[model samples]
Target: MSDLVWTRGVEWLAAAASDPRACKRDWDRGEGIALLEAGRFWDVLSVPDQLGLLTLDLLWRPTLPVPGPTLVDTAAHRVGFFLPPDPDSKWIGAGLRHAGEGSWVAVPPPYRSTRFLEWLIPPDGTGELHSPTTLELALRQANGSLSVLAPLCGG
Candidate 1:
């Protein structure tokens, strides 16, 4: 949107989990990397997926390796990672910014004791900054060989 500095054409992204345990829960159910941010509670920006429209979760950079097809946002200081659709899902390379209330809810990075939170430029009240990382490097880190930081999930 005009408000935020985000990159378009990013193939995919990953965000910090609202509940780390939930990520494990969904993954445990065979749902690879699904998040509550990707569910109906948030006004998700969606693209076409194998199932239909895969609701994309918000992230600036990735703290954890999101093993799937993905794109990166160079701005926002890579403060988080955007969760992508499934690896095989074909993204349309397009999305719409949510404008109405209760749409595009806060999808923060995993909480930490040391790091401080930052907002999207042109600040919108959202979640805390977890591990801010660019999406492209994150993909490489996820799939390729790169030492990276692990995602946090508060206990």
Candidate 2:
């Protein structure tokens, strides 16, 4: 499964986006279906229960099949997700500086039942002010233009 998806979409994406991590192979070949990259896993998330975790960037929560189709069909697409290579991958910092640009996107709360924005990565990449996405700093590009990088894991 990993080899298949990685070859189809991730391969071209990795080169097009210039983010090899997105196409990195899971050599370990662990278990529980790889939802994204190497660490992200796909859990039986029937409903998005963790809205607080949402952010203006991208959301990659394990999702379970609703009520139709089958596991094989859903996993083929839903399970394998992707996002632009951001500060997390150590590429933005190496290429762009923080003062170049910034963007702010309002991350809608999951479950489609919330009335507030779970999180918002300020135009200057200050979304980490509330919760850090592992990067010590989030460098936003000028005029919110990343050239090719995607903001989050999901499209």
Candidate 3:
């Protein structure tokens, strides 16, 4: 189930973008998936309520490297989820960071801010697309449930 969840998340990320060229898989060794775009790195396979989204920039390097994923706890605190290099295990994490050229910002809770914009998942209870602020608010209100957070973020 973990592997499935992780894989699904990666798939969702690949599908989220209208331009397939924007999503590139640098590595997928059954242990985890590594995606890249515009020289930025996104390595976490995040499954929020069956919606998959990847975190970018935290693991950028010139060589193959594995950075731990972020995991939100029940207390709504964000932390890292490091996993051993195993093919059969799924590591869950919280608070995905958005990384770009020499700049990175930690995504706020999906229920509190609307700065994290996503083009994949639609807004909840409304047909309108999600804005970054709305997604952050949703994340804050989700109590660390990725299932709840992912949808609001358009994953």
Candidate 4:
């Protein structure tokens, strides 16, 4: 049952790839990650891992929002959260990057967790994604908190 869910989830993510067949082929060949185009299925909000994790903590507090797919790239020291695409969307934060129209993001298969690039929150094959507004709020709060503490930590 779990295998089927993961398989479906991978299929759901592969649709974002420029070439779904090639993406599947790379996964079959045991490649660690594949680059998938954004804007077709979803957009990505990327930030430094520390701030991203803090934002996640804030997002989970009080009550959980509908969970969305998230990626962590330890090698790049970045974390990416998937959100429904909005062509004109602009995100503002100290370390935030918006990958919306005409952007590509490296993604590991939903069932795979590579050492560097892996899923922090895997898709459930339901095509659900994070709310951009909610994510922005959490990111804003986290960024503010981190910035306020940076000097204290001498960072």
Candidate 5:
């Protein structure tokens, strides 16, 4: 991906961190590596009904033509919204697929959308999320509420 695109995504992530309504959730740091190794892009999604954070795994070929350098051909992206293991609850998995070109349609919950937002920063405030550049790029890709352009432009 181009540096600018990556930077934008990082800014968005930082801005999302500032969102009061955005819930703080924990995710595996290794998941990012795993997704890249598996040729997929994974994102974190926090749903109101769920108690903890959820992961949306986009299982795509990454070989098709995309608009930007960061864009990749999406063979099939799946959203696996799961609730972390708890004393009273087991891991639940839901599958969402891409429908109608750029839309990701959940099979179980029945939600449809071309784009969904996921938290790039973990709740712990450690790992890759700490980098200002990383945060900017994530937020740019998210087109999130942070309005991170100012920081990204060195404002």
Candidate 6:
């Protein structure tokens, strides 16, 4: 990404924090990640790393792609996908967690990936987010595939 585009994306990501300045200061101080509150600008839906990876592939394979900012916590074995905030949306599935309306999420700088925490798909500063319905469907498909493959993989 160009410097200007990345700068805009970083700015957009930082705006999610209550104190955007503090987050920027921490980043400037070499902190790898900052905790940003959810529900203000957007919400996060997180799932197990394996399922998330599968969902991501499914999401991107469509003719009309569902692109969104995505984060992966390797150490935690989870992945977070950014979505537009909706108080009424209650996501349900095993290993699925929603960070919305008062929850907080650890966010990495948009420009690059850090140790343990990285962005699978970085924000583009356009404020675009994944469609909740599309993501839900993809997650279901991914979960089904995993269930079928688990026995074969001996997991």
lDDT of each: 0.28, 0.22, 0.32, 0.86, 0.24, 0.89
RMSD (Cα, Å) of candidate 1?
Answer: 16.4
Give the residue spans of candidate 4 off by over 4 A: none
Error of 2 at 50 (Å): 2.2
Which candidate number would show the highest TM-score if scored against the true structure? 6
Each prediction's total of clashing residue pairs, residues at least 3 apart in sequence or on different chains, is 17, 7, 31, 0, 20, 0
Off by over 4 Å in 5: 19-58, 62-91, 94-155
The digit string of per-residue lDDT tens for model 1 on 1-155 reads 32231221111123334555565444334423243344322222222221111111332326443222222222222222233223232323323222122223332222111122222221122321122233333333432221222233221
lDDT per residue (tens digit) for residues 1-155 in model 6: 89987888889999998888888776666756889999988999999999999999899975857579999999999999999999887898888999999899988888877678899898888899998988988899999999999999999
Count of clashing pairs, candidate 2: 7
Q: TM-score of model 1 relative to the true fold?
A: 0.21
Model 2 TM-score relative to the real fold: 0.17
Compute each candidate's TM-score over C-alphas.
0.21, 0.17, 0.22, 0.91, 0.20, 0.95
lDDT of each residue in 61-155, candidate 4, tens digit only: 65866558888999999989999999988787677899998998988889887669888789879898988888888888998899899999999
In candidate 1, stretches whose alpha carbon ends up further than 4 angstroms from where it belongs are: 1-15, 38-155
Please identify model 3 stretches exceeding 4 Å from their true place: 1-30, 38-97, 102-130, 139-155
Model 2 accuracy (lDDT, Cα): 0.22
